[model samples]
Target: MTTYLLKSGILLFIFYLIYRLWLENEKMFLFNRIYLLASLVFSLLIPLQLISFEPSATSKIISVQLDELAIQKNSQSFKSLAESLDLTNIILAIYVTVFLVLIIRFLLNLFSLYNKVLRSEVQFVKGEKIILINEPILPHSFWNAIFINKQEFKNDRIPSELIAHEKAHLDQKHTLDILFIEFLQIIFWFNPLVILYKRAIKLNHEFLADAVVNNQFREVTKYQSLLLEIASNKTNIILASNINYLITKKRFIMMTKKESPARIFLKVCSIGIITSLLLFVFSCKDNPEESNTKKQNKIEKSSVGIEEKSTLPDEDDTVRSLAGLEIKPEFPGGIEEFYKFVGKNYQAPEEEGLKGKVYITFIVEKDGSLSDFKVLRDIGYGTGEEAVRVLKLSPNWLPGTINNKPVRTLYSLPITIQSPD
Candidate 1:
C-alpha cells in the first residue's frame, strides 16, 4: 500500500509540473480542462500497472519491488496480526479516522445544499429552473440548478451575465467534475498534490465559464468589471461552482490572450511525447519467458550447488519483499501444509517449557528454493537453529513473480513451540 501511494504521488507531481510549465497559462480553456482531468486520471492509472509495454532491448534492466513486507506471525490458533497495537495499526487507525471525518463533512455539505433547494421557491426562466434563496451569498450552480438571491430575483436586480455564467456551469456539467475531484481528495487527503489539483480543476472550471460569458456578451471590459464587482461577495458553499472563484490576474489575462494554431499543436505534441516517456519508464517490463530462460541457463552453468551460488546476477541480487510481488511465494501445499511440515520435522530442544515464537526469514529464489536463512528472534536452547534445520529439509516453494517473471522474494515465518505444559 505504501509503495502504491508513493508511485501515485510521484506521478501526480510530475504531471502537475507539466501543467504549470506549459499548459496552465495557455488560452486554450477547453484543452486545458481536458489536460487537467486526464492528468489526474492518468496519474492514478499509470501507477497501477494498467497500461504495459514491451521493454526496449537497449534499456537497462531494472527491478521494481517492495523493500519490506508487513511483519506477521503464526501461533497455535493463527491469530490475526491486527490483535497487536503495533506502529502499522496505529498509522492505519489515524488514516481511517481522517477519511471518515472527510466523508462526513462532504455528506453534510451536500445535505445543506439539498435542504436549501427543498425550502426555496423555484422559478423557471428561459427553460431553466432557478432556485431563489434568501441569502446574501454570491450566485452559484450545482448540477442542473442555478441558485440566486431571492430579493434580487423579486426586485429584478440579478444580472443576465451572472445567470448566463451559472447556466454555462450547469450546461457543461462542471459540478460532476468537482464531485469527482472531491472524492479523490477524500481518499488521498494526506497528499498535498491532491489539494493543488482541486484548486487547478476549480480554476479551470471558472475559466470555462468565463470564456462562455465573454463570447456571449462580446463586451470584454464590461464583463471584467462585473467579475470584479462579484468578487467582493463571499461564498460559503465549497461543493458548488461559484461565479466569483479566483478572479485573479491570470484569469483576466487568459480571457483576451490568443495562441496560434501551430503553437497549440506543438504544445499538444510535446505533451504526448512526455506521456509516452512516462509510460515507457514506469509501465514497461521484461519478457517473462526470456527472463526465465536466462535464469535457467545461469543455473545450468553454476557447478556450485544452488544452495551457495544463486542464479541472480552478483551485482543485482536484491531480494524483494513479499508485498511487492504479483504472485506471492507459497509452500508446496499452502501455509497449512507448511505448518504441518514444520511441526512434523522440527525437533524442539530439550527445554522444560518453551512457550514463545521463533522468528525466521529466508529468501525464496527464482528456482523455488529457500536460502539465506536468518533468525530474527528465537527462544533459547538451540530452538532457532532447530527451526532453520527444519526449513532446510522442507520442499521447494512456488516462487514469486513481478510482472509475471520469477524473482527472489523475502519470506518470514514464526513457529510457536509450547512444551508439554
Candidate 2:
C-alpha cells in the first residue's frame, strides 16, 4: 500500500506539472480532462504489476547476516514489551480507523445533499430535473439535478447563461468524475496529493462546463461575465459543483488562452517520462535462486563423501540465514528446549559489570555443528566474549536444509548481562 501511494503521488505530481506547464492554457480542454483522469487511474494500477526482468538466483553465495538483524534477546522486561506491541497491527489499526472516518464523512455529505433534494421543489424542465430550493445561493449541479434558488427561478432573476453552464455540467455527468476522485481521497487520506487531485479534477469539471457553455453561445466574454456576477454567491453543499470565484480567475484565463498544437509534444514527452519512472519504481524484487543453487551443490558434494571443502574468499562468505533456508534448523528437542539450554549455560558477565545485550552469530554447518561464532555487537567488560563462550559450548543443532539436503545456515542470538547488586 505504501509503495502504491508513493508511486501514485509521484505520477500525479508529474502529470499535474505537465498540465500546468504545457496543457492548461491549450484549447484541448476535453483532452486535458481525460488526460488527468486517465493519469490518475494509470498511476494507481502501474505499481501493482511487479514485473522485474532480473533473475532470482546466483552461483557465488555470500553471507548477508548483518543486513538484517534477528535478535533473540530473552530479557523478560524488554521481551514482553516487544512481543506485546506488533508494528504491523498498530499500522493496520491506524489505517482502518482513518479509512472508516473518511467513509462516514463521505456518507454524511451524500445524505446532506439528498436531504436538500428532498426539501426542494423539483421541476421537470425539458426532460431534466431542475431543483429549485428556498436557499439564497448561486446555481450548482449535482448528479442529474440543476439546483437554483426558488425565488431566483420564480422572479426570472437567474441568468440563462448560469442555467446553461449547470445544465452542461449535468449533461456531461461531471458528478461521476467528482465522486470517483472523492472515493480515491477517502482511501488515500494520508496522502496530501489526493487532496490536490480532488481539487484539480473539480476545477477541470468547471473548465469543461465553461467550454461547453461558451461553445453553445459562441460568446466567451459573456460566459465569463456571468461567472463574475455569481462569484460572490457560494454554496456550502460539498458534493454539488457551485459556481464560485475560488477558481473563477483560472477559468476566465483558460477561456481566453490560445490553442498550442506545437506544445502537445511536450505533454506527450512528460507522460512518457512519468510512465518510465513508475515502471522503474515498481519493478523490483530480490533474486534468491542464485544462493539456493550454491547451497544445493554443496549439499550434493557432502552426500558423495567428499571430505575436502572449497575455501571461502572471506569469513563472511557462504553464510545463509533462517530466511534463506527452505527448512529451518531446530534444537534436538524444539525451541523451548533450546531456550532451556541457553538459560542453563549462558551466564551473565555480572562480575565484569556488563550492562547490555551482546549480539552473537554462528554458522550451523552442513553436518549440524555450530562453527565460526562471531560477535556482531558488544558492550565493554567481556559481555560479547561471555556470550560467544556459552555459544561455543552449546550442542550441535538439527541442521537447516534446502531441497531435503542439509545446508549451512546462519543463526543469530542476543544475550544480555546485568550488573550485580
Candidate 3:
C-alpha cells in the first residue's frame, strides 16, 4: 500500500505540472476538467497493473543459497528482518484511520447542506426550485436547488446573470464532478495531490459556467463587473458552486482569452506520457505475486537421505519451491520422521505466555542444508529463540531441483505452541 501511494503521488505531480504549463490558460474548460479527473483515475489504476517477462532458455540462472542467518524479534527490538512483512500492516492501519476521518468530515458537510435546505423557504422560479436562507450566503447552486440569502431575495439584489450562471452548473451536472472528487479525497486523504485535484475541478466548473453565462450577455464587461461585486461579499461552500475570490481572477482572464485547439493536442500528449510511465512501472521485472500459505508434504526421503526431484517455477514466477518440483526434498525416513526430530528437540518456554503460532521461513540450500532461518512471528518469552536454536542444530536434507538439476528452494513453516487448556 505504501508503494502504491508513492507511485500515485509521483504520477499526480507530473499530471499537475502538465496542466499548469499547457492547459490552464487554454480556454478548454471541459477538456481540462476531464483530463484532471482522468489523471486521478489513472494514478489509482496504473499501480495495480502487472506484466510478466519470461526468461530465455539459455538465460543464466544463478541459484545462490542464503547464508546461515538468524533474525531475532522480541518485545524490546522491532528492527528484526521480519518487520518487512509487518510494515505493510502498520501502514494499512494508519491509512484506514485517516480515510475514515476524512469520510466522516465529508458526510458532515453533506448533512449540513441538507439540513440548511430543509429549513430554508423554497419556491419555484420558472420551473427551477430556489431556496432563501435567513443568513448571509452568496448565490450558489447545489443539485437542482439554488440557495441565496433572504435579504438578497427580498430586496431583489440577486442578478438574473448570476442565476443563469448557476443554472448552467445544474444543466451540466457539475455537482457530480464535485462529489466524485470528494469521494476520491476520502480514500487518498494522505495524498496532497488529491486536494489539488478538487481545487482544479472546482475552478474548471466555474470556467464552464462562466462561458455559458457570458454567451447570453451582449456586453461581457457587465457580467465581469457583477462577478467582482459578488466576490466582494462571497460565502463560498466547498460542496456548493459559488463565486470564489481565489479563482475569480483566473476566470476573468479565461473569459476573454481565445480558445486554442493546440492545447487539446497537448492534452493528448500528456495522456500519452501518463500511459508510458504506467506501463513502465507496472511491467517492471521485480513485481512479484505474494504467497502467505505454507507448502506441505514436500519432505519425502529415501534410505540414503537423497531424493531426486524435477522443479519448475512457482505460480507467481518469483520463487522456486519444493511444491513446484516433480520430486521434492526430504529427510532420511520421510516428512513424518523429520517432524519427529523437531517434536523431540523443540522446547516451549516455561514462562507463562500467550498460546500462539510462530512462523518461520528458511531457504533449503542447493547442498541440502537449512540456512537463513527467520523467526517471522512469535509470542515471546524466549519461545522464538528456542525455535531458532533447534532448527540450526538439525540434520541436512535433500535439496530441491529444477529440470533435474539442483536448485535452491524457499520454504515456510508454522510451529504452533499450545498452552494447557
Candidate 4:
C-alpha cells in the first residue's frame, strides 16, 4: 500500500507539474479541464498495475523481488502488532481519522447547501432555476441549483451576466468535478499534490465559465468589472462553484488571451510523451529473458545448504520466487490458520521485557516439505531458533506451482516477540 501510494503520488505530481508548466496559462479551457480530470484518473489507475505493457527489445527491465508470505504476528497468544501502537499503526490511525473528519465536513457542507435551497425561495430566470437566499453572499452554483441573494433579486440588482455565468457551471456539471476532487482530497488528505489539484481544477472551472460568459456577452471589460465586484463578497460553501473563485490577474489575462492551434497541439504532444514515460517506468514488466535470469539468480541465492532428503527429480531443482508462480503455496488451512499455529506453538525467549522481531527464511520444496532454513536475524536469547522450531513443526504447505507443475518457492516470515511486563 505504501508503494502504491508513493507511485501514484509521484505520478500526480508529474502530471500537475506538466499542467502548471505547459497548459495552465494557455487559453484552452475545455482541453485543460479534460487534462486535469484525466490526470487524476490516470495517476490512480496506473500505479495499480492494471495496465501492462510489453518491454521493448532494447529496453532494460528491472525486477524487484518481495517476500511471498509476509504474515504479521497477530494471533491470540501474542499481542497483535496493531495493538502495540507501533509507529505504522499510529500513522494509519491518524490518516483514517483525518479522512473521516474530512468526509463528515464534506457531507455537512452538502447538507447545508441542500437546507438553504429548501428554505429559500426559488425563481426561474432565462429558463434557469435560481435559489434566492436571504444572505449577502456572492452568486454560486451547486449541481442543478444556482444560489443568489434574495434581496438582490428583489431589487433587480442581480445582472443577467452573473446568472449566465452560474448557468454555465450548471450546464457543464462542474459540481460533479468539484465533488470528485473533494472525495479524492478526503482519501489523500496527506498528499500535498491533491491540494494543488483541487486548486487547479477549481481555477480551470472558472476559466471555462468565464470563457462562456465572455463569448456570450462579447464585452470582456464589463465582465471583468463584474468579476471584481463579486470577488469582494465571499461564499463560504466550498462545494459550490462560485463565480468569484480566484479572481486573479491571470484569470483576467486568460479572458482576453488567444492560443494558437499549433501551440496546443505541441503542448498536448509533450504531455502524451511524459505520460508514456511514466507508464513505462511504473507498469512495464520484465521480458522472458530477464525473467529467466532473475529466476536463476533467485535459485542461486537461495540454494545454500540443501538437505539430502527424499524429494523430486533432479530436473525440478529450479527454485522460483513466489511472485513468478501461477498458483502460490498456501498453508494447510489458510494463511490465518498458519499464523495461529505459529503464535500458539512458539515460546517466547526468557529475556526480561524483550521486544524485537525474528526474521526467518525457508524454502517450500516441490514435495511440500520445508528445507533450507536460515535465520536471517535474531535478537539475543534464542528467539530466532524458537521461531524456526515452531515453523519446522508446521504442517506441509500446498507447494506453489507453475503450469500445473509444483516448484520450490522461497518464503520469508518475521515474527515479533514482546515479553510481558
Which numbered prediction scores highest in lDDT against the true structure?
A: 4
Cα error, candidate 1, residue 415 (Å): 14
lDDT of 3 by residue, 1-421 (tens): 4455666788888888888886787887887888888888877776554342323333212222121122222222212223543776798899889988988888899998899889989988898889999988788888888888888888998888888988888999989989999998887787788888888888888889889988887568999888776566747787888765365677889889986567667667866876677667554443111222212122212112433231112233323211234346676687655555565677776656555656565766778898887665566787778778887887888876655876555655556665543
Tens digits of lDDT, candidate 2, 308-404: 2431112122332223445677778975556556656665543443365555667778777888876655665676786678778878888877558
Per-residue lDDT of model 1, residues 318-400, tens digit only: 22122235777778988656665666667766555556656566767888898888675566788789778988998898887
Location of the lowest summed lDDT over 10 successive residues in candidate 2: 311-320
Pairs in steric clash, model 2: 56-289, 57-289, 57-290, 58-290
Model 4 Cα lDDT, one tens digit per residue, 103-170 = 89998998999899889999887688889999888888999989999998899998988888889999
Taken over the whole model, the C-alpha lDDT of each candidate is 0.74, 0.67, 0.67, 0.75
TM-score of candidate 1 versus the correct structure, residues matched by position: 0.74
Model with the higher lDDT, candidate 2 or 4: 4
- Candidate 2 residue-wise lDDT at 134: 91
TM-score of each: 0.74, 0.68, 0.64, 0.76
Model 4, residue 66: C-alpha shift (Å): 8.1
